[model samples]
Target chain A: MNFDLVAQLAISGLVIGSLYALLGVSFGLVYQTSKIFHLAGAIPFAAAGYAAVWAAKSLQLSIWLSIFIGLAAAVIIGVLILVLGYFPLIKKKATLLSLFLISLGLSVAFPNLLQIVFGVDNLPLEVYDAEGNPAVPFANPTYASGFLTITKLNIVQVVSSWLLVIAVLYTIKKTALGRSITALRTNPAMASAVGINNKVVYLVVFSVSSFLMGVAGILITLQFVANPTMGLQWTLIGFIAVFFGGITSLGGSALGGLILGLLSSLSGIWLGSQYAPIVTFAILFLTLLIRPQGLFGKEAI
Target chain B: MKTTNLILNASNINGGYGKHQVLRDVNINVGAGEIVGICGHNGAGKTTLLKSIFGIQPLTSGEVVFKDKDVTGFNTSKVTALGMSFTPSDRPLFRDLTIVENLQLGAHIVKDRSLIADRIAEVMEIFPILAERRNLLAGRLSGGQQRQLSLGMALMVQPSVMLLDEPSLGISPAVVEKTFEIIKDLAARKGMSVLLVEQNVRAMVKITDRVYVLRNGEIVLEESGDDSRKRTDWWQLF
Candidate 1:
């Protein structure tokens, strides 16, 4: 029993789990409210990473400013997809299946579009100096305590993800906006009768959801490198967390992500890291077979 | 039919699910402070007519005049903002929300916090049981209490016209009578016009000022509530 190895895996799991939690909440918010599959969320996630890289390289902006620009781009792109893609179809009385198909088409096409624009190479999130050399502006620093080691980016991932999640949870529980969202989610017909603009709420949720995805994308890019195809994979993990936790409860989704991360990491002790997804799928299969409603979900998805 | 101070009028309302028309040239009107009833059996387009007027269900062709303005094709939120509120038959209240939370959302369009609070207080006065169980989830309430809370939520907005799909649904005979009394009292007291659809013709006719009998997506007969009560052959109309 390698106790040191177990401790290291646990720390790594927590960091990755926090990122998954952020993504889970993002995906869960849109899915729970409108029941949209929202695969086009990948567009914004990839775009945010690319946008941050572009702002850093082309605009020569500070890392913070570039990050903000990336987040803004995510929000704008998300709103446009709803306004241009979903709203018109909704007006024509499109079915949920039709909308999900549209999202599927967009999700597939968007990465190809990014490939054409940004090429197949992964882009490092770094600023260029006078010598035309790429340099990381906010380079992640390593911190070690006893047998455990962590990076600055890892700490940021955990702190920022939980903060945003808490803010969203609070907003949903205590604010009028949250009440309006709850009304829409719980009973859409009554929501409209009470003068809640469903489309407006959709726009807000899309913006917020995209913003969360943007943050996740940037954090991942900082830890590694931005790639055109990264969004779909990360987002897939997010929805998996959502289903694992409970689609009906956001907090459940977040907790589900954390547990998933820990399990995926801890499994490395017995199986290879590559088999983590296999474990995840097995858990999902068992959940479907047994619980079906998820750990925190009161209703079946 | 002659109506005094007409608050809501739907003319030639035609609507339905895709390729399955439910409402056909249906026209109805309710006067200010009037309690109008639409009675029919299941699948007679009673709910369709109410939804069309309230703008939840889209009308293929119709002209809805509310407070003297042609509000054709207005969505539910717009219609609600124009002082019309609709409560559906199934899941009328947000079951997950507390009674107070549901009432607050009843006035979602109102930006004034104090006004919303005042409206909630007024609703509490009207439905005292709601005040007693103010913090309880709406889903936890008894069938009769849920109906009362639904009406109480509608009253939160102080709507000029309220469209209720079925008020007598899922409640006992004793509660049904009491619910009707509360509805009648609310309309008489607040001068709010109510257009409720019900299959419970006997119970509905008692509290209504006028009743329309719908069959096959069209109004088969229209009569004063008094005349409706005198007649015992409602099954023939349905």
Candidate 2:
């Protein structure tokens, strides 16, 4: 492994890792607050990605407006899940395992539904020049020292992910709503006695998590092409990152995302692309077997 | 005799987890400024009765009237909003949160932030140990302190009716004495109505104004606190 090749791998890993971190954080957020593993969370990401492109092209909207529209769509989907899925289950006092299976079923149902509506064809957004040819612009000039090239998108992803993480951490640590969430997690009965509405809190958590996941999906779409079938893969990667970080620990998930990204990149470099998924799954299986609680997860009662 | 205002009334309530039916048509009441002690053997439906009143458990048949309103089947949050607070037998505290945070959560229904803060401060004064350990995580507290914290949390809502289940279940004798003292003080000083459920009949009788001894999911005996205390056969109820 040459220095240039290692640097390239490192840079790409960090970019992909930040995306994973965003997805993983969304997963952790809903899981910690509501104890619901929303497998359908991934649909928001794929939906948002496809919606962003459709908004820009069909609706003739700007990039930023399209992103906002995508986010709003995600929020609406999330609220629907809470109203239609979570509320009924909780009201019925359904077991956690039952809720988990329901979420899994929803995950499968949502993307296929998307496929029916959007078609199974993969759509890549095109950037065209005056000549109607594919145009790739270097937004920020990269300083190439040997073989390592740094791009503006990489910087945006890394810097934005860090800023978002910091903001979320601050909110959780300093805000009254955050305190209520913590209270709910620790003792829900006591939280209610204290006057916190569990349903409202769960709604807030699910919406926020979904919004972040939507943003992550948009980012991934920008990097790759949007496909109806991409949700499952994104969900799998997010779950792995979440478990790697420790299911309950947000900070742990962020670190886990970065580590998984680095591992994937290194595997792709050394062992070839075909070995990447195997390595990721191998790590996930071993982690579950050795530390079912994840690296920082609390023991479940 | 003056008719005492009834704050909470549970009439012929039957409730349980699944079909077990721990509470079999139990009738209980708490009057304004009254401390009612409910003593029963394990699985005798004391906790179930309290839980049904607090909306933690659903009643199969019967009605729970609070302050002249039928509140049976209301969710726990709605019940709390109607000025009732419950501390369960297990003393469920937000273990990861600081004592102050835990107390703040107790007053979550209070929309006016400043009023909530004032209530929290007032509660801290009553449980000074909680104030002293305000920054400590609830999990680190002693069993007695945890119980006090749980009680304090219930009180933070400034509930007109407070439900406490086994406040001294796992605490030391000294802590139990202190707990009973606090219960007595809250009743006398604040005129708070309490439904105290306990397995320790003797200690419970000392602070309670009235006692209901339950056995096999039914009220087997009912006596004034003074009469219950003087009776030599009180141990037979347990």
Candidate 3:
């Protein structure tokens, strides 16, 4: 057996899986509370990546500062969409289909607009050291045991993802805000009667989801490179993870994401890297066929 | 009814779901510490009336005066913040949440955590079944127990007035009787006014101070609870 090849595939899968898990959790957070679908979350994902690159290169800031600027930009964009796009239609009691279409339109339009402004090239955000040197991502310390090797970035992704997932779960499961969100999710009309502000919860969900998206975007950019169209595929996968995991449970989404990541990686090893996307659809189709409610969903979608 | 001690007065409410026009200039009022009942057949605008008064449904024409202030078309949250809670007939409790979680959300307007805990304990004292299964998801409870939890949740806010769409929905007759009894005791003990809508006229009139018999989207008979109980031809209205 090819131990080195297997190890490489497994490590890569975990890194991507952690990213997918973060995105899935983010999508689930908003979708569960607001029931908005929020397909346009792609705009924030790719935009943040591009924004970080621009900030690092043009603004000449440290890598951490650029990422901060990028996240801030993503949050502002998200809030603007809520104010300009969603609130009016929600006031009029528009259907979910209408909201989906509005979001899809923006998702498609904004990323393409980014292409026009930033050009079609893939922008690689450079991390700088204190002496103004492009930091070597490879300089991350590595740990190896048996056939498996791990780097600082890999550990960071996995550890941080779990930490974030745990923190979010704790907040939603144990905190008052989380309880209110659950109430809003379950019965919105009754939530209002009980004095839970739907608009406030909606804003909170969007902001948190947007922040998660920004973090995922920058993380992926650090590993690979940022492009306007990078978000389209990620958005599709995020939805798949939500359904595959279960729409109602945040923990389920993270689990689904990791499972999807592993499956894709294994498929790449068995078949070719080109066949990885096929594995995603097949699993989703199977999950829908067997358990449309998803792994952790209380009710079928 | 006398205008002077009224806590809530919804006058001439005319509205519906986008031109359906379910409620037509209907007036309903609940006096302080009085348990007023709106008894009607299904689809007689009973739910719509409650929705309008609770600010769940927007009224095209009407004035909702609570505590002597005209709150015409305030949304549900604002109405809730101003001390009014409505319990719908269908799935009154958040089924996915635990019993205590549902009760905790009941006091969403209350900012103080300790105060909310006290309210939960107070409500649980009235409905011991909720205390028994406080950690269990509300959906897992039996139909009767779920209904009890729903009313217990409304009590968490300690509101001045509560609007309950129906009392006996999705519960057994035995449970319904118990629920009505609890309602009577709760009203007297808490000193909170209640605006209840129910299909069971006998059960409603028995516990209520006043009863409004609604038919075909209008109140056809308004009588004191004792008068309503004494009436021989009560079934003739339906």
Candidate 4:
């Protein structure tokens, strides 16, 4: 009923929505190419955060260097997961179900491994001076409008996420690689007939998807300290966003994330935040019941 | 005896999805600059023969010679890289991509980007309508235009041989007529060999230099295009 509250909720929703969109793109890209429900996406999502934290706290690096190392780790681990875990199965012509299970197992096991090594506590990488308060590169700088307050970090997160997603969409729209990805998504058999190497595409798709996931992990960690198991939650949200957006379409995923974010934010405002999960589930249920194809998706979710 | 003329010569190829063998010792060949047709009813292994040659469908036992090199067990992308292009019957072009983009994808095997552009230009010139609609998505085109784009995409590779499975699969009869003409023109003008699989035997036999009639899972009949055209009772071959 209150307009100011509504606007505030909307701003936060848009921010969260942008983050979800980035994550959704990450999840959707690999699925589109390989049709593997890459649950192990959670591995890089957590790994990148942990890597950044470790690089900062242990290796004594700058925030930028740490973030870079984290992203690099994400790409390598992402491809390594596919190569060691999925590629052999892929080569064997194992079914999507098999790949999904393998990814799911890795997803489950990796977080626990993180907990084992990193402990059950949150891994907040805070640099410090002699006083030991905190030495953060960029603090939560705010940008306020009439009765509406926003942070510089929020701006960075939203802008970077949307820009990256847009760049991917542009590449998909204008570039040769994008066309090949579409070709593979449409008819892989025809893709191979046209001389698009399946192995190479698979590697590229995994690496790109992983890089996006890694970036999400690092940025989120910087905002709110990384934990051992934070990835599982994001992966769950990311996967939900993918299906909600129409699994095949990148734009659909973004729109899906926005809608999901808006609904959750609205629920949090009016229904006391406790009902956010309920709202998301209700949307999921309704989508499954009514338009499983999603807003812009061409196929059934 | 003279294998040099054969751009693709796949012999004793036995394969299928699994358990059920669709292609049984299927021996087929496409001579240099020849248009070869394999005609059969649906599920009669016509498509399977093409798949085996392209190496998309792994053979239980076979010898595939492309440009007289043993390319058996090579992946489809490898086969494509070795101057062979295949336009499958179903959704050959990436419907979401523009005609030019589809053509660019068709020439994926070509390492040189400039050569790819030139090939795209050549393809567009061959199919002028595709040029007009180069920016348009292949999915938006009429069924005929989609077929043209699909063939043009394959032709962009400037392949020594192309394996086309039912270029007229889901188009109008008029489109089918035009498609066959284009295939004939491409083969003659480009000196490209084609091994085409079609359920539309009448149209296919007309343009093809030789016709191999497949039945069950084997080649039931082989005849010259001239002889095939003369025979009104071609159905008896199956």
Which predicted model would earn the best lDDT?
1
Candidate 2, which segments miss by more than 4 Å at Cα? A125-146, A298-301, B1-3, B18-20, B235-238
Q: Candidate 3, residues B1-238: lDDT per residue as tens digits? A: 5635999998888988897988887888889999999977778899989988887788889899998888777877777777788898888889889998899888878889999899898888888888999899999999889888888888877778989888798888888888899888988998999999998877888899998877877878788888988977867787
True contacts kept of 2: 0.67
Residue-level lDDT of model 3, residues A73-144, one tens digit each, is 888888778878999999998999999999989988887898899988988888666677776343378887
Q: Alpha-carbon error at B24 in model 4, in Å?
A: 3.6
Looking at model 4 chain A, which ten-residue stretch has the lowest summed lDDT?
A128-137
* Model 2 lDDT per residue over A101-180, tens place: 98889888887888898888886643444455542222355556777887775777788777776676677777888887
* Backbone Cα, N, C clashes tallied per candidate: 0, 0, 0, 0
Q: What TM-score against the true fold does each predicted structure earn?
A: 0.96, 0.92, 0.94, 0.90
Q: What Cα-based lDDT does every candidate model obtain?
A: 0.89, 0.82, 0.85, 0.85
On the 0 to 100 scale, the lDDT of residue B214 in model 3 is: 77
Alpha-carbon shift of residue A119 in model 1 (angstroms): 1.1
DockQ of all candidates, in order? 0.75, 0.60, 0.70, 0.67
Least accurate 10 contiguous residues by lDDT in model 3 chain A? A130-139
Q: Model 2: which residue pairs collide?
A: none
- What's the best-to-worst order under DockQ? 1, 3, 4, 2
Clashing pairs in 3: none
The digit string of per-residue lDDT tens for model 1 on B1-238 reads 7988999989998999998999999989999999999988899999889988988788899899999999998877777778888888988999999999999888887789999998899889888899999999999999999999989888877899989999889999999999899899999999899999998888898999999988989998899988999998888777
